[model samples]
Target: MDKSTEEKIYEAARKVFILKGMEGARMQEIADEAGMNKALLHYYFRNKENLFKAVFKDIFTKFFAKLKDTLLSSATTREKLTVFIDNYIDLITANPYVPSFIINEINRDPKVLSSLMFENFMEPAKVLKLFFNEVESANKSVVDPRHILTSLMGMLVFPFVARPILQMVLFQDDKVAYNNFLEERKEVVKNMMFKLIEI
Candidate 1:
């Protein structure tokens, strides 16, 4: 198939997957969204699972590529944590549906997370080691770096994952209000991290 046609199908599939999720999304719907026939979509992807896997991998890459770069960089731990928080807030805010979609699919099929993890080759342990080294160099009070990392991740991601309820309860179902709240969280999360690390 031509590159343009493939891109059209990819984008369409991404939309359908994000909106309807893996089990709910239909091949015909994706074809309609792509302005192509179902046969053409199948020609490129072979099946819905294949198409979903491609879309899932693409979303996962977009979400984590910046994180990997920031964590692996030579910046100080404080600086790395700050940058990571900022990047994470920006990424999740821009693609709010991504977290929920991935979480929901992982819940439906436990293997989804494992497959994505293997495909991404993300060694979170190394990132945690960087955190541990930072704390040791600073001679801070001893603590499990895993807890710190999990706390940081949970703080950053929870709002996006719980957006629907938050929007209703906190923002009166106003999208603009909810978005402003997220924008505020960028600084809030950074400050919280700084406080946690005593930077």
Candidate 2:
């Protein structure tokens, strides 16, 4: 019932889930990692799914909150894009397991994406408007902004999602090399987006 105890459980669960993923993680392992009994772990979280949901939602909420703040700032749309891509790559690099875990869970159960209690805090429509304004300012034909958004997301996230194969095939399983690749990708994605939108 103590807040510190709950925090300990949460942190333990987060590490276990990150390392083992949803299906592979066990409540007993989390309990052991937290230095708590299984009963206490269940008392705090009810089940593995509930604990995973809490962790997943917290990570996504924090990420979207940062994204929302950046998008709403007074910077130019191009500047926002650079900032967004840089921050996103940094987050994914730091939490390497999160993107793949989220994508896998969503693929296994589509409802998981919708079940998160967070509101549409990212305000995607407003972000899309920024894209549209940028395109218009560039005197480009009004294309669907969703395509641009998806491209940006895919470019930034795909490497993290496909990290294993990328590391094996591209970096000879050299982790340091792959990490450097990710760092380089931040600038590459920004340049690619600028070229695509002629910004």
Candidate 3:
């Protein structure tokens, strides 16, 4: 129950939950990962559900914090687009399991998804609304910001989420090629968004 011990437990739990997902992760795995005893792990979290929820909440918090800073700041539209694409790509690439983890958990208990939306936790939709408003005012262009945002995120995220299939079909299991493609996406996504939105 010291701070360092508590931090260790949380960090271990996060890795386990993200890797195995909520239903698949076992408390023993988390305990082993933390180099702690089951009793002590229970002392901190009391149950697997509680521990998973804590880790999931932390993940959501970190995600929202990054997104809010990117979307809400007073950067120019181009700057914001670059920031959004860069931050989103970096986050998904680094935490390759996160998008699927969230989707799986929410699928199991849809109420959790609703709760996140109701609580306005890093509300991507709200951010899109603001960006759309700006785009309309700036150019009166016909582009839908929501569509653009979805396309950008899908382009950035789909490959990582479907890496196994893409590897077999597209890259012939060439990780080097996949990585190079992802790196190129950093610029490709930015250019695609700018072209779609710029006046």
Measured by lDDT, the strongest candidate is 1
> In candidate 2, what are the lDDT values of residues 101-178, reduced to their tens digit?
777777877776686643653365566577567655763645566677788899988998898998999989999999
Off by over 4 Å in 1: 122-125, 135-139
Q: What is the Cα-based TM-score of model 3?
A: 0.88
State TM-scores per candidate.
0.88, 0.88, 0.88
Write down the lDDT that model 1 would get. Answer: 0.82
Native-referenced Cα lDDT, model 2: 0.80
What lDDT would candidate 3 get against the real structure? 0.79
lDDT of the candidates, in the order given: 0.82, 0.80, 0.79
* Candidate 1 lDDT by residue in tens digits, 41-127: 889888889899899889877777778877877577777877788888988777878889988987898876777776565475566
